[model samples]
Target: MIRRDLLLTLFGIGAGQAILLAVMPFLARAYGPAAFGSYAVIVAVAGIVATIAALRFDLALSGAEDASIVPLSRAGLLLPLLTVPFAIAVLALALRLPFGAHLPFRSDDLSLIGLIALFQGWVLLGSALSTRRGLFATLAAAKIVQPLVFAFTALLLLHDLSLAMAVGWAAAMAATLPAWRHLPSSMGWAETRATMRRLWRFPAISAPMALLDVLALSLPLLVFAGAYGERTAGNYAQVQRLIGAPLVLVATAGGQTFLKHAGDRLRAGVSVLPLIRRFVMVMLALAAVVTVAVALVGQPALTFVVGPGWRTDTGFLLLALLPVLCRVIASPVSHILVLTQRLATQGLWQISYFLATAGVLAIAPRLFGLEGTLGALACSEFLLYGAYLVLAVRAARAANPLPALSSKTRPLSASS
Candidate 1:
């Protein structure tokens, strides 16, 4: 049942992501490098802000089985709500600054940035709730609708890439409102307040882990932008978006399903070692397949999607990061840590990775330029996969000591 749900969810998400991936290069070409650069900046800022505003509630929601959606919802709303007013004030203040006078775009762009941030926050929150309820189909359907709306609307109403992104995101969020109606109506002020208190108890540990995870994934782009410039960042982002579709669709959908079941099994004192071992093996195999497939067809695929003149270097970057396949494979193990409430340990590992990767990117860029930065990123992922493997082994062993060495048990080192 879990596998079925995962497959369905992946199909839906993968399809949508694939479409977006195909469209991005065309969009980049049509908009030109500067517009693409602007799009990247807006996305980056919005992504970071949205991560902060969500306050790690999305991950927290995966672990929450309590009947207090109201509090969870309230807490989710409050953090982003606070940001809305502050963002306005900051933008207002920025307009008064001398630096603001030198910018190409008006103060209104800041408002648009804030809107994107708020929309992302809501999307994350809504996604958390949807995932918790096993509303995989609904969530998957929403993912599909968002991109189509964004694509068509951008191409039709406003040919501006940045505005298209903003509109598409807003429309997507608006489309997801119906999904929220599926949640129980028992949510209220009292339930929301209590859930907030309970949630706060763990955010100190989980928030950083969540932040690190996002950083680990996102910081590479920033490094690319800083070292090579926005054009380079735009080019790399195009590939990342393409490759990320399958990685997220399969790995993420599987991780969510695994978490729901694994949590229940752990609480019931079921041995999850065999399951973890099987999961690890499956992910490794899938990663291998995806890596090879992408390597074989990636260049032609990119050309076909985005048209001529789009940088082929993006394909090389995608091929370079192919080892991230292993990282995607190991995602379930990380999800298990969250389920087990070992978020502090998880956070520590992720933060260590972020710091290590950031340091590498900073130093490497001065030495080798864009290629050097990509090399740093690849090395960082390899190190992170090593760490994740160790954690997964320890977790599996701890989850079922009796089955520690069963033939069905695959050793983590062996898997590596």
Candidate 2:
């Protein structure tokens, strides 16, 4: 079942991501690094806010019941609405203040940026609502719809590049309307507020982890813009997005599969150690093959597809990926922390990682430049992920009271 769900998710998400990837070259041509850099920052901010706005109530969808879903999603849905307006106010005021210039957005961009954040929260709500109803296909379809709309809308809005990115985000989220329909009717303001109080731990604990996790991606873009320049931020954003394409696809599939199985296996006293170890090994080997192939033809390929202007030196690219490489290994293992009910521990690690990465990206660049900073960030991530894997394995071992693996234990293969 784990393998099957993973394969289906991969295929569905892979198809959608492929279309998104296909349109990126055109979007890249339409918006240069500086413009795209600003767009990246906007998108990143919206995404970060959206993740927190949901308060990870979306995460409780799979195990939660109908009575639980409404109030949770209602609270999540209301968050961005209330917060975005305040955020816009703060951003507007900030732009008038001394540190305003340091921000990634313009005064004109603030309202749309806030709206984008609001829409992203909607997307999160839709996903949770859909998942609660077991509408995985709807989730998958929405993934595909988002990028196509983004690419199409981006081309049409070439005159206003930043606006294009913002609208594209909104459009993508809107495209998944059906998924949101699965959300149960609101349980009234009083009941919803009560539920929020009930699930305070999600906000207190998982929300921080979610925020830290997002900051891991957003902080770098913000720092790159601040430390280097808009162009450098754009360049950094480009590399992260391009490289992450394949990595995230696999990670998303692995995550869903891991969550799906980890619960059942834990309840059954089954060992996931062998499975986790095998998953890591398989990923490493796959990463090696992909890395080698990309190294051999990456430059030419980028030039041919994305154009020569977007190309960076092969050696420079290779040296840029301490964080990226760490993510490759760690992303799959992330679900384990959740499976083991280790949100507090995971949040601490996330806090440490965000601080470490931000510190390195900020200070290391002055001493060792881009490569050194990336390397430091990557090394920190490697250590964090290593500890997470260890904890996950320990938890798995603790839960496995069964004598040993038997024929009843289904392998990750299909034949069984």
Candidate 3:
């Protein structure tokens, strides 16, 4: 049943992402790279804002039991609900600032980005609630709906790709509220507060980690924008959007299912090492296949989608990034660490990677120029994957004890 749920979820997300990947280059070509870059920056900012609004509640939901659904729902809804106004205020301030005002878009872009953040927060909350309740089908459906709406809307409204993208995401996310309403209710105010207290502990550590991690991924675009201008940033952003398509599909879909199953296994007193190993192996295989395919077809694909003017010799860089994509695919390791109550270790590893990547990026631009940025990214991936692997192993060993030391040890017995 768990395996079926995993496959279904993956299929749904994969279908949605395939549509997104197909439509994005067309959108980029229609709107031009500068507009696409503006879209990327807006989305990046929205992601950061939504993360803040979520306040790590979704992370908490991964380990929550079915009985905790009502409390989790209340807490999840309240946190983002409370944070949205503040997020909007901050966004407003950002728009008024010289930096934000310099964006190659209109004031409506700010409003659209803010709306995206709001919808994203709601999705995080809804998805978390659904996971806690084991509503995998509903969650999968919700995810599927988003990209379908986005793709169709964008295709129909081809003139304004930016507005089309924003509207599509917004409309799809709006559908989730009704879906969430269908979930079984299980608690009231007191239970909500209790759950809130437990979940609140996460953001204290996760917030810093989330911020640092977002900065690490987003800094390259920021740097490109600063050094080369919006046009260059736009080109880089378009390539990144294409490269990220497969990665996000695998990461989000697989990672979501892994968290639920791994958390269940841990709760049932099952050893988590085998699950981690299996996840890593699967991710590595997927990444390898995708990397090779992308290397062979990426240029032609880009040319066909976005026209021949878009110059991004990022195939080598994308190939070098296979490890990072693999690492992202196995992101559930971090979730497992959190589930096992090892937040400090997880936070430590994340911070270390961020700091290391920042240092590398600092020196990279001077060395290999554009390619150097990619090199730095690959280096960061190596550091991150190594750190996570070590920590995940240590965590599994500490959780199970017997498997860590014995060379001939059999797989830990499944408990749940």
Q: Which has the higher TM-score value, candidate number 1 or candidate number 2?
A: 2
Q: TM-score, each model?
A: 0.85, 0.86, 0.86
Runs in model 1 deviating more than 4 A are 21-25, 84-109, 182-187, 313-315, 318-320, 399-416
User: Residue 43 lDDT in model 3?
Assistant: 76
Better by TM-score, candidate 3 or 1: 3
Clashing pairs in 1: 70-192, 71-192
lDDT of 1 at 221: 69
Q: Which runs of model 3 end up more than 4 angstroms from their true locations?
A: 91-108, 175-187, 312-323, 400-416
Error of 1 at 352 (Å): 0.5
Error of 2 at 165 (Å): 3.3
Residue 194, candidate 2: Cα error in Å is: 3.7
RMSD of 2: 6.3
lDDT of 2 by residue, 157-270 (tens): 456655665666676567657766655564588987876776565678888888888887778778878777888888777776776555766776566556556655655667
Taking the tens digit of each residue's C-alpha lDDT, what string does model 1 give over 97-212?
98766333356667677877888788777777777777777778767877877777766688866667777777767755765785566547776665666566345666656666
